[model samples]
Target: MKKQLGNNYYNIISEDLDGEIYDLLLTDVNAALFDYSDHHKSNKLPLKSKFKQFLINRLFVGFYLLNKLKKRYTGEMIILSNAYIPLNVPNSVTLLPPWIFSPKKKSFANWKIILIINQLKFILKERSIKLLLSENFKFLVDKFELELGNLFVKFKLSAVVVPNDMAFFEKLALRVAKKKDIPSFVCLHGLPARYNDIDDNRADYLIVWGKGIKELYIDAGVKEDKILTFKHPVYSSFSALELQSNLSNVLVLSRATCGIPCESSQLILTDRSTTLHYTELVKENLKKLGVNKATLRLHPSENEDFYLKNLPDDFFTIDRSSKDDALNQCSLVIGPTSTMVLDAIKMGKNYILFDPVFNGLTLEGMPLVSPFTGESFIKLSNSLEEMKYNINNPNDNISYHELNNFLSIDSNDEEKFLGIMNKNK
Candidate 1:
């Protein structure tokens, strides 16, 4: 496909077809697969009938109505609420939903007519993308452009901050901000899983947690100047606590059964049988380490019932406390390529990457990157023998230098955030 379309492939999907928007909505195409364009032929979405599309197009009416009542944000810096977890932006900055931007218009008829015309133009534009993109994409583009474009015209937004650039409304907001010359920032919430051109700096500035993440982006062709590195508050304010003396309680950071459709080429990476098999193995191994009372800290998306139904009675208990509290309870934490590894280490607990190598790759489909991989303070165990060796010899860990490499806890993160907010001023 790359050879057939050449550079036009990029122009068509990104600009002409608006691939990112469709990728976020439909989950059929992953726009982040720009470097791996050959995957397109295999992942093409089946086309829907024009009648079904017309029904889907009506969803825009609700989207427009939702924004109609939302009062226009009078503040300079607007942070999308979803990004608030990682980026604790100051209270002075007005936080709003990514979709609610356009203010109430006088007449709905005028907007309806515009919507109809845009849908017609979209359906007639490119035949190649007809199967990949549905009328849902056209209406989504119309809804966001109409709303965000209007919001920009009504108020001079100083800057826009979002959790990521891949989501439908978030990416569109950044684009609108760029067109209006407003500074845009992507405050990454967690360690990035994929590093492709489409996943690079979509905003004017990419605010990351540490140098390691910045390097990943840089290695993927993003310029150094485009990224701004800062300490995450979670690490900056984290004072080292004494390791739990009684090593009775244990925590297993179990992964979600399904991958996020928007982020993956395939959704079901590891099946229930595979996940349950690993859970039983973890339980048996814990017993060997003289630990019996262990709890399962499942991914936020997973249900407790799935594990309860499959696993043997009295295998592992469920952890339902807050993340900080949960870490405080467990002296040792075990997981496979999880972001929670940092949390465990920050709380002065021992963390092991219990990665059972499946065909030379971790459970997340790729090998762990720096800080998590290579020589680090954290222990990594790929096999049952390696797991036993690392678990038995708790002192095999390195120093704090690697943690700093992943997330520097020395910087004034709040100050840097304020500077970014006032950059355009």
Candidate 2:
């Protein structure tokens, strides 16, 4: 049987812990655990090296921040730093420091000892799980559980809202809030890319951008009642499509090159080599279509300096402005399956989902769903030839009215979000 790491990890912990701890705490850890096991084709990193990473990545600054900022906010709604709650809700206090900054502690010696003991127990009981418990992973579990539990008590927060349940402190906050009888929610910040039980929602309610995402989650096994659709606050303000005279400059959205380990699944989605290869293909194909120059808009997470130095060719100009500004300048947009496609269409710009087939399948290695899948509504290109075809035929794409069901253009999102949040509060 394929190991359902999240379920398995939870079952084992619930059997031993004997507490009111909700299952959400372990969700993020197991998600990363599954990805980690699939990533390391070779030997595991040494214990010393693992500890160093744990300190650098999780503890050093994080520990200090947690203690320093514990008294900073005492409100009804506690927002985790990574939550990205776009709306300006009342009685909300956002933690400034990220979860990577560890809570202040005299020494990690006791936690390290507890981790070793747990590792030995895992080795004897379940060898498969033992492989998942690296020094860093174990430290994260113990450290966050204790620190976040304390933070919840300190704030006396009645409601918790987060962007996702997949991040360590985010899931931990949900779990901790549940134990304290405080309602928790996930206010989706962007278009969801994956739909599966592995990416299950831990929050009581998942506040989505539209019915499109809500339906996708229901199909993926999430309960319908647990989902509440709210139009994106930003997308609601989308300007009416301005008629353009000609297809001037084309804008290409370039996402960061991330490995399988960085994601929640074992799927071979993107790699450094494949990403660079795809870029080369885009530049070459655009040249074939008589387009000498196009703007390459990098993902927000990407560093401009790094991409400038590493990009295959200087044939393209880098886009540094906001998404709205960039889309306004460009007459035509081409890129992979992303939320940016929605933005491009909202601005009256014709967009082509450039999902070129790499090895008999799309670069994602699987078929995507809805906004990315519905070729009848949106233009999708599986090959370079198709990309050229879609660009030439700009009229063959989803209309402005057709996009309403996905993201409503009405200004009632603020009211909807407030209604749901008030009920929970």
Candidate 3:
């Protein structure tokens, strides 16, 4: 579709799509949304006492609601609760109200009946609360789309750019863009990993970080023309950092408890326990290799208090610094399957893959499929003993040239992204 605004400009809409390329767009709209709290910090509590933790989570929710009410009544919040327009934004861009909830819209009785039936399916399940909230949020997002459609018509939006197509709002925005006859693209936020039953049919195009992700999407049945390769705007800045000489510290990146889907509930519990268990085992192996100076970097969604209280007191120090700093300081990095590994590769740092869930398992039964080809550059350790050997005898086989074949780590990220945006215009 051609530019409807009579200029080569785009309207970027997302909650977390902020950065250089997004900043380049003169017209942008953002939704102020809160992240869903991970209330079940089960890793910190005993298996039998998790029910009590759930009750504590309920109390936390009550307090959170009260805080929201205070923000609403006091006019301290913006977007949903309070009304305010940002002065820093350019006049061309239009920021919409927060799409959290619609108090004016009444709940449909038929929708409530459907939600109740869905809740009944998970009545006795452990993640029932998550299911209930997700269902209700989807209903609200549908209403939010109606409001957005009107805004798109009034503003004469040319195109829509989103961070990803995973969330309810992102998908809804894509639908609105389609109905209005505008191009919609979802930019790559992180390294794309293979998962079962993922739907990638929401957006008109996918903006990926490199050729590696492009190939992965193609393998997942996405059209080749719909996938575009562009260097990550943020990480491209790290290409200038010089590798330090004293790269001896080991950094262990921890994954979230419910990061992946399992075949059954038994597998879910086993996956969580085994991940935590193997992480501790990695620490012990590092100590045996005389690498006492190490750090454990928790996922943003992970509860730090849970790990600090539950894990061994003196096993490894927790590093809350930025990921780039941690990767630069650490000589060797290890993790199960994360985008951090790609960051390390881009920075010329050595890394080892230690996914206990799928390292030894067959491809058919693996919990998660790796995106990389697992070439000799990226070493794998099946057991603690193997991990120790890899740590002690480090290899310098992986080079930037080899990684470039997979990831397009070029410096002209801004130019490349704009080229794609203006292609249709």
lDDT of 2 by residue, 1-425 (tens): 12323355455654643332333334333434443331232124557766876566444444554455455543356544444545577876554323333343222113333344344333322324443345554565566566656655655555677777765456666777777776777877777766765454777777787776778888987888777766565574344455342336888877444433322434343544455566677888788777788898877645455556667677779888888899888978878878787677677787877766555455656556677765435767756677776776666555455466566523564576566556654
Report the Cα lDDT for residue 11, model 2.
Answer: 57
lDDT against the true structure, per candidate, is 0.59, 0.59, 0.50
What TM-score does candidate 3 get on C-alpha atoms? 0.60
Model 1, 1-425: lDDT tens digits are 01112334434555643444434433223233221221122223224444555664655565566656555545544544446454555543444543333233221223544454455445433333453355665665666567766665554455777887765557667877788887788878877655654553678888787777777788877787777776666764344445432347778888544322323233323334656766776777777767767888877656566677677778688888999999887867887666786677677776767766567665545555655664555666756676666655555653465566566622554565578667654
Candidate 1 pairs with clashing backbones: none
Model 3 lDDT tens row, 338-420: 77776776666666777655464522234555443355235566566766655555443234454556666334544544554
Worst 10 residues of 1 by lDDT: 33-42
Candidate 1: Cα lDDT at 174: 80
Looking at model 3, residue 375 earns an lDDT score of 52
Once fitted onto the true fold, the runs of candidate 2 whose alpha carbons sit more than 4 angstroms away are: 1-82, 88-140, 237-240, 243-247, 261-266, 303-312, 321-325, 346-348, 358-360, 383-389, 392-395, 409-425
Candidate number with the higher TM-score (1 or 2): 1
The alpha-carbon deviation from the true structure for residue 397 of candidate 2, after best TM-score superposition, in angstroms, is: 2.2
lDDT of 3: 0.50
Q: Native-vs-model 2 lDDT? A: 0.59
Number of backbone-clashing residue pairs for each candidate, in the order shown: 0, 8, 1
